[model samples]
Every structure is written in C-alpha cells, then in structure tokens.
Target: MEFLIAPIIVALLASALALTISILDKHVNNYGDVEININKGKKVLDVKGGDKLLTTLSSEGVFLPSGCGGRGSCGACKCKISTDIGPVLPTEKPYLSIEEINNNTRLACQIKVKKNLDVYIPEELFNAREFSGIVEEINDLTYDIKEVIVSIGDESIDFVSGRYIQLVVPPYGKIKESTQRAYSISSKPSERNKVAMLIRLVPDGIATTWVHKYMKVGDKLRLIGPFGEFEKSDCESVMICIAGGSGMAPFKSIFHDMLEKGEIDREVWYFFGARTTKDLFLLKEFQEMEKKWPNFHFIPALSDCSPDENWDGEQGLITDVLDKYLKSKITPSKHKEGFLCGSPGMIGACINVLNDNGIKDIFYDNFA
Candidate 1:
C-alpha cells in the first residue's frame, strides 16, 4: 500500500510537468513569417521565421556563399546587417574582424530570421548559380590524383580563369548527409560548356574516397558556383606560380586562358613540385607549351629524386628551389606576384618565402 502510494505521487508530478512544458512551447516557439530585405530592398523574401537566415535565403533561390551549409562553422556567409537582428553571438566572433564587426557584419548561418531584417550582400553572389552536369571523363594524372571532366550541356560555366567550384558530394556509406567540397577548375574558361576538376585521394576522406572508389564516369553530379577571388591580377607583374599535388588545377586553367587569348607573353615562371619522379605529371604538355610560347617557363622539381632517375632539373625542397630562383634565376627588381595552392602548411610556408623575396602581391586559391 505504501509503495503504491509513492508510485502514484511520482506519476502525478511527471504529468503536471509535461502539461506545463507543452503549454509553454505552444506560445514560446511560434514565430510567424518574417520579411527579409536584401541589398536595400532590391530583393525581398517572406520566409518562415525562426530558421537561420542562411537556410531561408537559400530556400528563396538566393544562394549565399556558405561552405558548411548552415552549420555556422565556415564563416563564409557573412552579410552586412543594417538593422539590429540581435547581439553578436560567440560562434561568429572568431571569424569576424574588428573592422567587420564595426561595419555590422554577421554570419548569416548564426542569425535567426525573427522579423523584418535588412541585409546587404555582394552583387556578384547573385550571379552565381547551381549547375547540373554529367561526368564525361576521368583521367588519372597520378596514382592518387584523377581529373574529372564534367559536361554541362548548354549551361555556361562563366567564371574567371582561376576561380574554384564546389562539388556537391552525395551521401555514401555511413555519411547520412551530403557535403560540398571545393575544387579549383582546371579546364579552360573559353570552353564554357565543360568543367574539369583535379582531385587527390585523401586517406579515409568522405568526398575523396567516394570520388576515387565509387564515382563513375557517366554519373550525374550537382555542383555550385565559381567561388573565391584568387584570379590573376591585372597589374603588370611577373607571375610566379608554385603548386604541388592537386593544387595544380587553377594554374592550368589560367595558363590555357593566357595561351588562347595570345596573352602568353606575360613572363611567367611555373614551378611544379612533387615528392618523386613518378608523382610528376603534365611535364610534356607544359614543356611543349614552353617551346611554343617563349615567355612561359616550365620548371618541374623533385624533392626525392631517385638515383636511377638521374634528375637534372631542380632537386631540393620546393622552398629551397624557389629561393634559388629568386636569388639567381629571376630578376630581383621585377615586380612579381606569387600564386600558391596547397594545404595550409604549404601555403603558409610559401607565403613566408615569397614575402622574404619581396614578392609582396601573393595570391592563393583558399577554397574553404
């Protein structure tokens, strides 16, 4: 009788708490539709409130530049806010600079669509669109690297020569959600109906392993945009491009564009680095181009050259080779711009070398 009475008392208390929570949620969680004004009301969207601004804008066919979808991690979806949406959250603070914060910049993925909000976005982002294509070809450049050529029908892939595209990888194996990986477009910009991407196999990587093992040549693909601002500058500076692994993608596109437009006489020095002789590719193509275009110089270097290979070219670490070229081969007074693409460690090291050599205007394809 005592045990029965105690059980009854606990059940009654639990029921009362559940009822109170239900009542509170009914009133507290309901937020009606909100209006979003973009670029001073030039574009407006009336979307359901309480969702993140990044998702709401994407639903309205307005694709904002977000690398991690709406996860609030990439910090690529920064937008200027005219009206006070809310105080800046902790998630967005690390990404935003002091100047950006003063300019009222906020991460769209973190800001919830609560009421009428005025946001300013870049005009160029409005031009970026989704592209559906079929993988026409996959050519192996190295044992771990493959080049995927996509045919986009009549849809144009209008982009600057050095910009990158996001590959939308569908869920595979245990990956429950799709993810987007950025790859620099290795194809020529003059060929508007086709896109080429160079991908390297990463160990147990979600996207790379799927591409290497699962993706077929004729499979359909959904990709987005020509993101990043790493294109060649218009200044009359000598171009010094350094790339290793799949980082060779964007520079290939740029050089082709230069050749097609007869702008090959730009005094360019392309340094391609690899661990061994077998890791090197595109030597014959670039060497042929070097013969055709007097201004283009192809410099292929190997860090671990075998004795049997008898490599006569630059044989040292890429940074050491670059340092040698800067001091002895390249003119010291000429204004030079450094183009680097690789992992963060490689890029940072290259930046330091370029800065040390007085090549101040350096650029890299930082595709987040």
Candidate 2:
C-alpha cells in the first residue's frame, strides 16, 4: 500500500508540472498576428509575431542579405524601422554606428516583430531571390583556385555582371552555427540557369576550408543572391579594372557579358595580379577574348615568379604595376571609371592609385 501511494503521488506531481509549463508557454511565448508595412504600403505582410524580422521576411519569400545566417554577427541584416519595437540589443550595438542608430536602423535578426511595424528596404532588394542548386562540376583552375559550377534546380537567376551570391554552409564541428559567404558569380549572365565561382582556398577560413576539404560535387546547395551595385555604367569611358586571386570571378562575368552584348565602344584594361605563375588561370581564355574585342586588354602580373616557371608578362606587386600603367600607358579622364575586386589591402591600394591618377568614378567590391 505504501509503495502504490508513493507512485501515485509522483505521477500527480509530474502531471501538475507539465500543466504549469503548458500554461506558461501559452501565455508568455505566444505572440499574436502582426502586420508589417513596407515601403509606404508597397507591400504588406501579415505574419505571426514572436520571430525575428529576418526570419519572418524570409518566410514571406523576401530574402535579405545575411552573412551569418541571421545570427546578428555579420551585421548584414540591417533595416530601417519606422515603428519602434524595443530598445537596441547588445548584439546590434557593435555593428551600428552612431549615424545608423540615430537614423533608427536596427538589425533585423535581433528585432522581434511583435506588433505592427514599418520597415524600409532598398528597392533593388525586391528582386533578390533564393535559389536551390546542385553542384555540377568542381575543377581546379589553379593550384589554389577551384572553379565551382552550380546548376539551378527549377528557375533561372537574373543578375548583373558583377553581382554575387551567398553560399549557405551548414554547421560543422566547432562552428555550431550555419553561415553564408558571398562569392562573385564568375559565369556569364547569358548562362541563366548556371552559376560559377572562383574559390581560392584560404587557410583556416570557415567557408573555404569546408569547400576544399569536405564539399563534394553533386551536393545540393542553397544560395540567395544577385545582391550588390557593382556593374558597368553607360558612359563613354575607359575602364580600368584590377583584381587578384579569387577576385577574378566578377571580372570574368563582366568581360563575358561585355563580349556577349558587343559593348566594345569602351576601352577596358583588366589588370590581374598573382603571387606566381601557379596562381594564374584563365589567361588563354582572356587572350582569346582580347582578340575578339580589340578595345579590351588583359594584363596579368606575377609578384613572385619562381625560376622554373617561365613568366614574361608584367612582374611586381599589382598596385605598382597599375601605378606604372596609369602614369605612363593610360591617361585617365574624368569619365574613366575604376572597377576593383580583391583583398581589402589590394582594393585600398588600387583605390589610392586610381585616385592619384584623377579617376574618381571608382567602384569596388572587396572580400575580407
């Protein structure tokens, strides 16, 4: 009798605890329907509240650029809120400057949409789409650079020449969280259903390391893309473009698109830099393109060429070569535009060179 009574009492206590938890969840965790007004009634989203704005918008098929997958670390998910949700969060403070906070900018991942809110986004973001793709081919273009081709699953992506896509990498080992990294699309825009990237292996880089060591051909991948404002403008200007290493991706797309569109009225000088000959790829293809487009020039330079490798092209640091060319071979006019892609250091150096050469209409994308 004593044992039976004790078991009954324990069961009653367990039931009571479960009931209490359920009641608390229903009251505290539940968020009712919320309304989102975007861009002065350009669109409205009726969603269940309690989730972050980023997740809610994504669920509604409005994909925002987020490098850390809504973790609030990358600071890419910024949106201007017209309606106040709450005070700024600690996670967002680091990324937001005083000007941004003053402008009522908030991290979408950290802001819970618990009520009717107004948010402002760039008009171009409406065109951004998520794509499901399968890795079709992975070829080593150089010793350190791998060319990856992804075939779109159902639909095609319409993007400009110098735009990029964010590849989603799932959590592995110590990462503990999934991440997304942006890579410029290397394939021409004419290849609507296919996208390619020139990936350089970065030692210990979270995404590159995974791609080099674990990722396999034929694996399914997801990406959100066609984001960025890097592209050619309609101006009768001489284009001076500079890149290094994996920076070749966007230029490849730009050049191919130019060739396809027959936009040879503008002169283009593409300067590609590498540490050695082993780091170079696609020279032959660019050479062929040069023949087809007389106004376009492909210049590849090696900074540290080994004795065994026979390299007769430009030699030295890329910036130095660019400075020499800008000062001597090319005369920059006000209409000249500079396009640059590479490491942050290379981009900065190239920018200085361009600015010194009186080329002010410069646009660049740096992968850091």
Best by TM-score: 1
Worst 10 residues of 2 by lDDT: 327-336
Q: In model 2, what lDDT does residue 268 have?
A: 96
Q: How many clashing pairs does model 2 include? A: 0
Quote the lDDT for 121 in model 2: 91
Q: Give the residue spans of candidate 2 off by over 4 A.
A: 1-30, 86-99, 172-177, 332-334
lDDT of 1 by residue, 88-129 (tens): 899899989999999999999888777889999999888777
Residue lDDT tens for model 2, 45-131: 999987779989988988777766776777888889989667788889998999999999999988877789999998889999888
User: What is the number of residue pairs that collide in model 1?
Assistant: 0
- Supply every candidate's count of residue pairs whose N, Cα or C atoms clash at under 3 angstroms: 0, 0
RMSD of each: 7.6, 9.3
Quote each prediction's TM-score: 0.88, 0.86
* Candidate 1 TM-score over all chains jointly: 0.88
